[model samples]
Target chain A: MCRMCDWLGEGQIWYKNPKLHANRMYKLREPGRKPQESLRGNIVGSNLHEALEAKANGDLATFNRLIAEKNAADARKVGAQPIPLNEAIEVIKTLQMPVAAMMCICRKATRAEEETNLNEYSCLALGTGMFKWERWPERYRGGVEFLKPQDACDWLEYWDKRGMMHLIMEEGNDFLGGICNCDYPDCNPIRQRVDYGLDQQLVKGEYICEVDFKRCNGCGECLGRCHFNALKFEVTIDRPSIDPMVCFGCALCQTACNRGAINLVPRSAYPALRNVW
Target chain B: MNVVINPKITVDYERCTTPFDCKRCIRICPPAVFVVYDIESHRGYEVDKKQPGTYKMLPLYRDKCTGCMKCVEVCPVDALTVKMPEEMLT
Candidate 1:
């Protein structure tokens, strides 16, 4: 379980519980206060877009300035926490409410050419948020199809098996927004955090991967599954070595390993990495 | 937003004979600037004894291109060419 879930998943995972979410939503909107209005405030996305433009033009000064500003802005705003796949599954199954699959907006924007033929319905929105989804027409584009808990689990597992990282987000800083099935190259949060040195959008998972050399066969399967570039084969040792610092604790490597040599040790166990996120 | 940078990616369509079969640029690009676009009529590439519908690569998010050139480096067929901005050249 992730630190966020461990701290928040008491009687009911704080965000998924309908009553708590309703309270949060009411607080956010509060009887006609500009409709709560995205809470994202527009700066983060705009700064990021500008930063990308700068980076593309090879304007290091501009890119660095924009990225720093964006990071600073993200640091001030409280937001979603990254949970491991297991915790994500637990949250979805326990919600006991309607879950819906929607097209991945990131994939659609970046990989437009592949949109027509690809099944980009990898983002899962949970809780009662679906009931009034029409309120946010932009988010509900192409509409949402309901999924049974079992089907939801299957869908999440399918994405996990395909090496997608599961990210549980808090909408408007409080509501359990949804779970995004993300990939390294296309997912904005992942790309920004991993490649651009921004850590505010998503926190690290609560566990870290450790490989036991004794029972290990260096088949190199787990190496490819790591999006953080944390896993690599030590050519001399002919075994996979994981860099703890770079590991997001997503445990995709553990799932990929057929040898059972990989384990997800609680991040708390390693004092140095406990607050690394 | 008409933004700071727009990368020029030239795809040698004639040389890019079988793009779907060889999506090096699409797979390797970190920014995901390249994507597969469907060509209605099946004009190229054969699969399972049939000419499957052809797909072409397009630089969909040209503004997002960071000029890392992973696509250029990865394309085995040498069909992709990238021209970074002058500022980027420095």
Candidate 2:
């Protein structure tokens, strides 16, 4: 289990808990207190040029200090954890708040691609935040499409079939906000973690995928689905091997497997991986 | 220790008036280092991208830049400039 589970799970995985989603729907503002800025807004305002410059100049101390400072400040803000498709649907089914399918901001920012059509929206916005998304025009451009729980599940399945990893995002401390269906360098959080070694922004899931060699064939269908490079085809054995440590438990490879050779087991089952997150 | 150098990217907002309409820098950069965003949107309201100067290009992830110069070459107005440190030439 991850630290989020320890803090907000209330004896269950944090994302799986319905109460967290319910509480985040409408946070009552304290009387006479100013409203805080959103995490995405804060991220946009932050200047990472100095840290990147230090990194370029081979100044490890300065780079580490700057990154650490930024991470510490963002520790209480938005963060995400990869969740399997079924669990993601389960979260949607259980939540009472509105679920809206919105254009992926990461895709727009990283690739300059726009999902103008309703069917093309790849990100799901949870809770009441979707109601007032017009406030953040840059982030919520092209508007949003509200979905029924059943439709949301089907939409999640569609993205799963398309080989996108499902990640549940926390808006504030212990407040569940959205579900992101994205992959690789195109996804901001994934890119930050994989390319820049910024792990705090996203954590591994509650499960780890394992390969069932008995039913396996070297079809190589599942190899390309892995964004983390955790799955490697063993040429000698003619089977795919999974590096348990590298797997985020998104189950994209598992879904892609035609032979049903891949299975996800609880991370707690392995003592070494129990606290890896 | 081996010395490393990175490209310093700058976009002259004056030379580049309409960034939303012309996204050459955003599209050409292989690393997707450049982002075109609305300046007024930060103030908590939507701004029309059709209005010139409302949107601007920013090199948000300069660390990821490989000094490819693709963005600079692709810029129609020649507003982008990528300069490497002089130490790298020594």
Among these predictions, the greatest lDDT belongs to 2
Consecutive 10-residue window with the lowest summed lDDT within model 1 chain A: A109-118
| DockQ scores for all predicted structures | 0.16, 0.39
Name the runs in model 1 displaced over 4 angstroms: A1-45, A56-58, A113-120, B1-31, B34-82, B85-90
Residue B42, candidate 1: Cα error in Å is 33
Residues A1-277, model 2: lDDT tens digits? 6777766676688787765444445564445544433444345334356776688767878887877766765555556889999899998888767899988888876666668767899999888777887776467766789999899999999999998999998776546778999998789789877866667778888899999999988789998899898999999898999999999899998889888889999999998999876
Chain B TM-score for the candidates in order: 0.78, 0.80
Each model's iRMS: 10.9, 3.1
Q: For residues B23-59, could you state the per-residue lDDT of candidate 2 as single tens digits?
A: 7788777877877666665544456666779877778
Measured by DockQ, the strongest candidate is: 2
After the best TM-score superposition of candidate 1, give how far the Cα of residue A69 lies from its true spot, in angstroms. Answer: 1.8
Q: Which residue pairs collide, candidate 1? A: none
- C-alpha lDDT values of all predictions: 0.69, 0.79
